[model samples]
Target: MSSTPESKPSALNPDNKKAPVTNSMPEHISLDKWADTGYEWAGEVEPSSFQRLATVLSTDHEQTKTQLDANLYRRNNVLHLAFTLTGNVWLTCQRCLQPVAIDLSDDYDIALLENESQVRLVNEEQDYLLLDEIITEQSPERLLPFKKLVEDEILLKTPMAPKHDDCEMTVEQFGEIPEEEESENPFAALASLKGKL
Candidate 1:
């Protein structure tokens, strides 16, 4: 969650950036109902639950286990979320062009707005998210699915260009070398010839 820093009394949960994200609360619910009691839930969702996540990952291999925790609460009628996602992942290092093991760990705080008009109420608060839903007479329902919410949030966190601290070009990617591979590199002879010249 990216938001402007503020110390106002009505500041949407200061922990939005530190918050964990969720699933299984329900397809949709009356925002007013949950806000009254300050509903909270935390749990892990399976890797397969992130259908969009797979397409962005670089590996043909399946994603390793991932764990996530999330809490939803509100301040002054403004919905806020704190989410944490952690686990192991294989991402291709943009520089090395090889799989790099990344220990996935990230936290997000998001303030969800019911309508753009409400932005003024909490515009100064950090990480505010307002979705513009197209409502028509045939499809007037404006509720977004719980699963979609989680997926959208997580997907936004994916790195555009994942990389390792050091690119290991000196080493061969395939560890096991065949017996014949013991031969010196063909470039070695070229270098030796250059020395003689």
Candidate 2:
């Protein structure tokens, strides 16, 4: 029995069309092509899926969730990505050292650049995604990973130091503080010695 090469999928074939991308799908896609077609994906994703984000979260990874609404389109010879992320995450409170539920909801508009050199040409008013030349030089994969993109957005929104607006617990409550005792001023002693001299 002989097997035909046409039966197998090949990345080299330019004519072969890929399946439509969805929020749940973990795949890399060509940003340029996706923008030309005006592709859109909307769905919910578990917070646990974001490995990097889970490291900083105060609560269990499975307890949180996020909703993603994204659209890719080309306008004015520039590829644009419009996305909205909404979710609730448990972050460690800086003051109380307890879990603080933070509501996360934000919309972003980003311009995708084919090369790092094009980043300088992008409008200062808009956000831009600069493709890494080093990575592309090593691999033929021009498509960007959808899951990694989502993870990046979440990481960007993560607070450096999250804290509650009004913490019921105070520093004094956490530990005991010794009362400070007053001592003679060094300047007064120096002045007395100078006077004697």
Candidate 3:
């Protein structure tokens, strides 16, 4: 919670006993006293808390890559996080329904609420969280939905599958459908009764 530079990370030593940072983009960052320092997203996350690595692969297809212009600051008891994420991603193609390469970039400005159970509900009229400087007895209960944002950004930028102008599957692959069989009209039997009326 102190603003001293020593409290900030400078460079990550793999041998250092701390969280394993997954990304290499912030290599010069130093984690002095955070647990499992590398991969863990807990504690006072500083700009240098991350590594200088380019990619942080959380899964086979899901990752956080590129430079992070992010910082964690606390004014009073409230925390504020601001950052921008830009990177290339692989997402499902919208057209062919296949994996497609995509470019993603997103900017975020989040006010960290201090309460353990702050209401996540937001006003529909405003685009920002309308809460004041709330004192939190615990770590923030809510954070900007990061994964969802990345997924949405990727989905928005994804191209239709088989993005090439000409796909391999040709028109011939679509076979023609047979015509429908004709059936006798049910009204035909009622024609005789109409004449009698």
- Residue 46, model 2: Cα distance from true site in angstroms: 0.9
Model 3 off-target regions past 4 Å? Answer: 1-23, 26-67, 100-103, 112-178
RMSD of each: 10.9, 9.4, 11.8
Residue 93, candidate 3: Cα error in Å is 2.8
Per-prediction TM-score, please?
Answer: 0.56, 0.67, 0.38
Q: What lDDT does the true structure give each of the candidates?
A: 0.57, 0.66, 0.39
lDDT of 3 by residue, 1-197 (tens): 21122123424335543334443222222212331122223222222123321122122354434443455443333444444556655544445544444554576555545453433433233123323332212333422333332233334444444243343433344677988989998998899689888
Better of 1 and 3 by lDDT: 1
For candidate 1, lDDT tens digit of each residue in 53-102?
A: 66666665467766655556667677766667787666667787777666
Q: What is the TM-score of candidate 3?
A: 0.38
- Error at 143, model 2, angstroms: 1.2
Which candidate leads in lDDT? 2
Q: Model 3, poorest ten-residue lDDT window?
A: 27-36
TM match of model 1 to true structure: 0.56
Clashes per model (N, Cα, C within 3 A): 8, 0, 24
